[model samples]
Target: MWSWVLHRITGVAIFFFLLVHILDTALVRVSPEAYNAVIGTYQTPIMGLGEVALVGAIVFHAFNGLRIILIDFWSKGTKYQKVMFYVVIALWVITMLGFTPRHLINVFSH
Candidate 1:
């Protein structure tokens, strides 16, 4: 249902983020000055917020992925799939709440 959709979406988002990360890291070997210029844009407040979204996506994707594994490997897992979905959501919310404020403070304070 919704979890399936979200898992796919988050997985795609994470994949793209990793692709960009690899590309950016590779840029340093190609041209240090160009790489530095590219990374400088990430210092902006907008990129700071993007980092928050990236973290959120990674957290949700990781938790939901474990839930999927449980459903696949644990015999009783299917019986509790709905509950596990809720648990994943609860964990995601708690994690984001703990992370967002501290990160925002650091991002804005800079």
Candidate 2:
């Protein structure tokens, strides 16, 4: 139940980020000035936090979805679902810890 809820939440979050990313890239076609402005906003603290959340959502969704796929394709995965769940959590934590600071620093330093 918790896994289902988390999968839905992360999937929705990733979809939302994808929409914003598409719009932002499309703005480049509309106007370079507008695109630069949008890009400039990424340096802000709020957007930094959003970036962290975005990375987390993407990582979680990808890893968990892979787990789900393995389960669907093979019965062996059912026995290891609980272990995989912890692996997913660990991966999420490591990804965030390693990437978030670098991402924020790059955004701000630019």
Candidate 3:
């Protein structure tokens, strides 16, 4: 269902983020100035939005991974997978609420 699709999407999203993160981090060793320039670009409002998306992808991926683990290891998890997806959603909302305000302020108040 939708959870399966989203789980895959988030997994891919996280993988790409990590790939970019590794490459960008490697720039630090090659040229400090280049790394600083790249880091400066990340401070923009557009990249701030990307940061939010990154956070969401990470949160969803973590919760969905937990769900998959339960489904694999727990006898009754498959029976309640939908309920667990809802639980993951609720947690995501709560986690986003806690983060969005602070991140927005940091993104915009500068």
Candidate 4:
């Protein structure tokens, strides 16, 4: 139940993020200085936290989607849904562990 709610929330977040990212990146073609300024704002500590959250949302959404796929395709996946959810969570944690250190280093390097 929590997974379902989280999956939906992350999906919406990623969707909106994609829209904003595209628009922001498009500013590069319009004006270099504008783009640089926007990019500079992303370097802030809060934005760094947002970046971590964005990564989390992406990873969780992806793994959960794969879990859904497995539940649809595998013959016994329904019976093992709990296990699959745990696998998704474990993978998500591992992915975050791998990403967080480097991201934090870069974030605080300023």
Best by lDDT: 4
Where model 1 places Cα greater than 4 Å from the true spot, the runs are none
> Candidate 4 versus the native: TM-score?
0.95
Instruction: Give the 10-residue window scoring lowest on summed lDDT in candidate 3.
Output: 56-65
Tens-digit lDDT string for candidate 4 (20-102):
99999999999999999998899899999999999999999999999999899999989999999999999999999999999
Worst 10 residues of 4 by lDDT: 37-46
Can you give the lDDT of residue 10 in candidate 1?
90
- Compared with the true structure, what per-residue lDDT tens digits does model 2 show for residues 1-110? 68779999989888888899899999999999999999997778888878788788889888889889877887899999888889988988998899988988886785
Query: How many angstroms is residue 74 displaced in model 1 relative to the true structure, after the best TM-score fit?
Result: 0.5
Give the alpha carbon lDDT tens digit for every residue of 32-86 in model 3: 9999999999999999999999999899889888998999999999999989999
| RMSD of candidate 2 to true structure, Å | 1.7
TM of each candidate vs. truth: 0.97, 0.87, 0.97, 0.95
Span of ten consecutive residues with least summed lDDT in model 2: 101-110
True lDDT of residue 108, candidate 2: 73
Candidate 1 lDDT over 14-88, as tens digits, reads 999999999999999999999999999998899999999999999999999999999999999999999999999
> What order do you get sorting by lDDT, best first?
4, 1, 3, 2
Give the alpha-carbon lDDT of every model.
Answer: 0.95, 0.87, 0.94, 0.96
In model 2, the runs with Cα more than 4 Å from the true position are 105-110
